[model samples]
Target: MQRFRYRFDLTSLHFWIVIIIAIISQALKAASVVVPSSNCYVLDNSSRIVDFGSDLVVRFCKDVESRSQTGYVDFGRFDRFNHFVAGSGQVDFVQGFYNGDLVKCEHSYDKLGRTAQVNIICGTCPNGQCKVGVGCICNVTYESTCRVFVELAIQCEKPGPRVFKGFTVGFHPRTWEIVYDGMTQLGFERSHQEFSFATEQTHVYLYMTAIASLSTLVQKPIVKTFPDIGLEVRLSGSGAAGKPPTTLSPTALVVDWRCEKARDTPYEVNITIPVEGYEPIQFTLTKMCEFTQTQDGDATRGWAIFGVLSCIFIILSALFCCGGFIYKTRVQRQHGIDALPGMTILSACLETVSGAGQGYTRAEDINSAFANEASWERPVSAQGTRRQSERKYGAI
Candidate 1:
């Protein structure tokens, strides 16, 4: 079989070029997964209770005198009013309004306890005996048109700045007549079945259901805000549906807000639904602008380090291969083999088999032997012999 020679030159510029190209391509491919503009922000203090309010009421009562068998009785009491108190424990004021002839308000705290309770009482009391004495009687009346005002406090757990895009509010289908008193006061206007407004506050409330029921209402309300507006406000906490009266309803109402970019100023959203069977359900939401570093930045840094390390590894590996190739070639030359053009392993094996039983010698020895053989095969020409004969005759 004919033998073939092959060489592997690791030190060649072409080999290094290929290795570098491969490493660079891999690094570029890894970097392509990250989008510079599409950075993600994590909600740090998620689902924290920012504010809560319950047991709100507005009373309209006047003192009146009554006659009794013993003498006259005077007592203080409420005649006409509107009031509602839902949820207990950690409840605070948000906002409220009552005016004109409206009376009687009731609500249930799905988050606090499942049990239904009368939280609000409005209107004048019926004829009743004064509690001061058995023989005494008292009468309470609402004379002039009165307005009721009830406000609750909201509590935020971790107040900080945040960035959000939009928000969504859920409501019950059956309770579509409940008006959002707090949202109305915040400058929200209702058009048809939708209510929307914007503010600079970061804390809001959602009110739903005057009583607890087995059936729940889930309504989603749209939020309207300037997309370019960025607000810097504090992020307190969030509440979901169901827990204490202060907490959101688990099934009745839900709210979700998404943030795209951070804003320099904060914004607020208020919603109200006027349902038939229940009072208006009102809530408020506050958006805060937060400027915090995200994980994508850190991941980008990690990828850069990894790419650098990979390039270093590839370079070291190429150097090692090239060094080994050079050393092998030098060793072959020292042993007197023709290693300048190098041979493949197969070709070397074939050459060894063909030259088996032959004496090994240096390249110089082989060259000299060929030269001596060529000298022996050369013949003298007739002219040279004739010239030699002539010279001999002359000498004789």
Candidate 2:
């Protein structure tokens, strides 16, 4: 009889093994789903390529106001205008603009004094912290809030030796005085609709009434400049759409400036927009950067691997089934199950004995009381064994 062999395959084991491998690979592929965020600066694409010179932008703007020309100048708050005129006081509009009236040549002379024509420059000055050319301070308090200004210092480069006129004091700012009032000037007790921003866009439009600038080419930002050019800026801090970048640069903040590399050098354009908080709006930012395609080939590979493993598993299972069938068929053929049929030897012997000895017996004494027929079934050994012996060694 053929015997079943387990050496060729274990089908259940093969199927489970393939299944486990597929799951592990799929889990790893699923982990690649995080998006990282970054900030970008966008500038005016049209006009930002021009050369920056004087009567041009300063790195900073200092506001000088006249408290009193004769009083001790508050070297602290710029209450005294003369000190704000800076070391290059002989030059006009160097650190800031001159707004006060000039006086004619003073005749009064001290021991070593030769009378000099005295001129005054006023209107505004940064709080006394003044640098000759790099930047200035902003400490003018008007109507409860501070006015914003630029950091690029405006130096006097014109040909004449000019002296600044003194400042005009008191807060009755002229119709023109209210100009650089920043966005915080706009009441904050209001709501607005959602604004849209792209992943790496370069330009951002903010809603604030002030002057602020961020440049890609320049290091320091310019804030609160001319009020005639009204602007409003919203940063992520305000719970608005725009945000200043905290990483990547220390003082170089990420605002709404976009960098373009049209020429060999990069041109940066920064724009601050004007708006109230009640409307829905979206802005555009342009930038030059790299992008990645998100589609991955791993999933297709997973399917392919699964297919191969499944095919192997199926082939192994078929071989197992075929082996089992062949083994069972061989066992049945060798054992000859058809050869064993059950039979009663007594009946077959009786047929062959030709009524092997019809016999009559005397009745028992118990017949005197009541008749009792003697009945018996002969053992299968008796007649059938006699027939078999006759076939083998002649009748006994």
What TM-score fits each model?
Answer: 0.24, 0.17
Residue range with the least summed lDDT across 10 consecutive positions in model 1 = 32-41
Give a tens-digit lDDT track for model 1, residues 229-291: 443222222224232221233223444343446655544544433222222334344455454
**Model 1 ranges with Cα > 4 A deviation:** 1-216, 219-224, 227-396
Say which candidate scores most in lDDT: 1
**Candidate 1: C-alpha RMSD after superposition:** 30.4
lDDT of each: 0.33, 0.28
Work out how many backbone clashes candidate 2 has. 48
- The candidate 2 region of ten consecutive residues with least summed lDDT is 161-170
TM-score of 1: 0.24
